[model samples]
Target: EPEVTQTPSHQVTQMGQEVILRCVPISNHLYFYWYRQILGQKVEFLVSFYNNEISEKSEIFDDQFSVERPDGSNFTLKIRSTKLEDSAMYFCASRTGLNTEAFFGQGTRLTVV
Candidate 1:
């Protein structure tokens, strides 16, 4: 079976630094999304991408954040300037269609000091 894969399962960074989290979803999946769970907090949807453009985004995905499918295989999330609040387990998800179940990657745990 296919599954999403994320790199650098753990990352530590300075409060004001930048970070890029990478993921590779199932080959045939179409809809891709980014979500995050802050320690002791509920999981939150950050953004969704389809057809090479952003389909939906939460307020959390502000000017500091961006997503890209740089090579049609790798999906990346970039945070321009990290903050303490930005520390969380970021998950990448994908689905075959609108109504299909989403498959999520093993989250990348980000820690900012």
Candidate 2:
């Protein structure tokens, strides 16, 4: 069985600092996405990437945020400057196709002080 894996299960940072969250998806999956859930809030889609380019993105993925696959196996999300509102559980997901079931990584819980 294939699954997504995330590093640093928990992170604590200052309000103005930067953070990079990492994920590794199943080897054969093509579609990758980043989603987040703020404490007490609903899960929200942040962005989707395919073919090495951004396929879709929510307003939440503004100038402060970026995603990249530095290596073929690792996907990363970088936040240039964190804010209190940026604190959330960030999840990485991937699927083989549009109709396939997406697999999500154990979310990385980020806390900003």
Candidate 3:
């Protein structure tokens, strides 16, 4: 099966630095979403985007975080200031349906040092 690719699969940085996680969602899908798993916690939705703008976002997607589709195949999430609580597996997923099964990338592990 085809897979979504992410760059810098793992990153470690000091706690106040900025970080951008990159992903290439499935080419044919219509909906894009960002989710994170903090340690062993359940996957939590951060945001969803479509039609070139944000469609929805959760409380976790606060002022510090933003997302964009920089090119034909790249989607990125930028965190203006990292926190220790930000250490988690950030996953990028895309689906044809808004509330159905989604294909998830292996994830970019962000570690706040």
Can you give the TM-score per candidate against the true fold? Answer: 0.98, 0.98, 0.94
Q: Write the per-residue lDDT of candidate 1 for residues 1-113, one digit (tens) a residue.
A: 89999988999999989999999999999999999999999999999999999999999999999999999999999999999999999999999999999999999999999
Residue pairs that clash (backbone atoms under 3 angstroms), model 2: none
- Ranked by lDDT from best down, the candidates are 1, 2, 3
Tell me the tens digit of each residue's lDDT in model 2 across 1-113.
77899988999999989999999999999999999999889999999999999999999999999999879999999999999999999999999999999999999999999
Q: Could you tell me which residue pairs clash in candidate 1?
A: none
Candidate 3: Cα lDDT at 42: 100
C-alpha lDDT score of every prediction, in listed order: 0.98, 0.96, 0.92
Q: What is the lDDT of candidate 1?
A: 0.98
Kindly provide the TM-score of model 2 when superposed on the true structure, using C-alpha atoms.
0.98
Question: How well does model 3 score by local distance difference test?
Answer: 0.92
